[model samples]
Target: MEQPPVTPRSALHTRPKSQGCFLVGKSLKPVVAPIYKKNGIFYAEIFLNWSHIVGERYSRLCRPVRITGDKPNATLYVGASRAVAAEMFYSVPTLLERIHHYFGFQILESMRFVNDFSSPHMASTFSPKKEEAAPQNSEEADASWKGDDITYPPLREALMRFQSYMRKIK
Candidate 1:
């Protein structure tokens, strides 16, 4: 697949560059966006998924961390409780073992946990509806199906052809 050319940041905007920092319009504050390299390497700024954390006692004690990397390299950083940390001083190896098994080797390197001040907010509660509503019509149902384009006839013909081919092989 052909990719669109990436416009250099310098060409798109006028800003002073110094020590890997860039300025945005009128604000002295630096603007930073996570830029992933083509080789599936990237950084992730993550906070705990508090809803999931708070619900489970074990997970809450040893807070689970989240990390996002560029495509094919996203990872989650899991932390341990003080006691757990003390017991296993060399924690990275164990954590890496779990991560490698769960997410595969390409996505993760290591885990880092610190006494960060922030915690993510939990979602509010909502009542489950007693009776779910049915779709009004076929048009509404078809509209709800996600995709850029829909060609049912061609898809149906393809499926029929595949089934015929399978039967012949059997």
Candidate 2:
């Protein structure tokens, strides 16, 4: 009788467990935004530029930014120059009143003015690029619209909303 050869166990059959790998050091608190928006308005919990200055000047100053809303929250982020920020800080309350008169709701809760030195990335990201001029006629616009169906929901909604608003005012 010939002796049978023994087979070795395959290393591919064994694998490491990864069940709790994602849960490590997880926090329960909602991370407050450096900025946020609700109901077509924008809010910021912290002014990073201001915070940096305060942190530099005083060792013991501590403050958490607060935002309040009752319903239908929407948040937006806009990057502006230091001059615009200063204007916003000084004029936002009066501006809000005018906005409410026109829109029938308060859109912005509060704003924080930040110095231009703080966030260069924001200004760069939103800066518009020079592009070929868009077609002027409806046919061109329709053709552009029909070329891609999957990615146009937001654009379509905005156009529809504008159209509706225009019709309502007319």
The model with the greatest lDDT is 1
Model 1 TM-score (2 dp): 0.28
Which regions of candidate 1 fall more than 4 Å away from where they truly are?
A: 1-61, 68-76, 79-83, 116-170
C-alpha lDDT values of all predictions: 0.47, 0.45
Task: State the lDDT of candidate 1 residue by residue for 1-170, as single tens digits.
Answer: 99999999878897656665445542522333223233222232123333232234434345555564544444555465445555544655655565455434544554566432222212122334479666898556544544334468778677667656655675
List candidate 2 segments past 4 Å from native: 1-77, 113-170
Instruction: Give model 2 RMSD, 1 decimal.
Output: 20.8
Q: In model 1, where is the ten-residue run with the lowest total lDDT?
A: 116-125
Reference-based TM-score of each model: 0.28, 0.24
Q: What is the lDDT of candidate 1?
A: 0.47
CA displacement after TM-score superposition, residue 67 of candidate 1 (Å): 1.5
Candidate 2 residues 12-69, lDDT tens each?
Answer: 5777776875743255223332223322222232234333423432212222233345
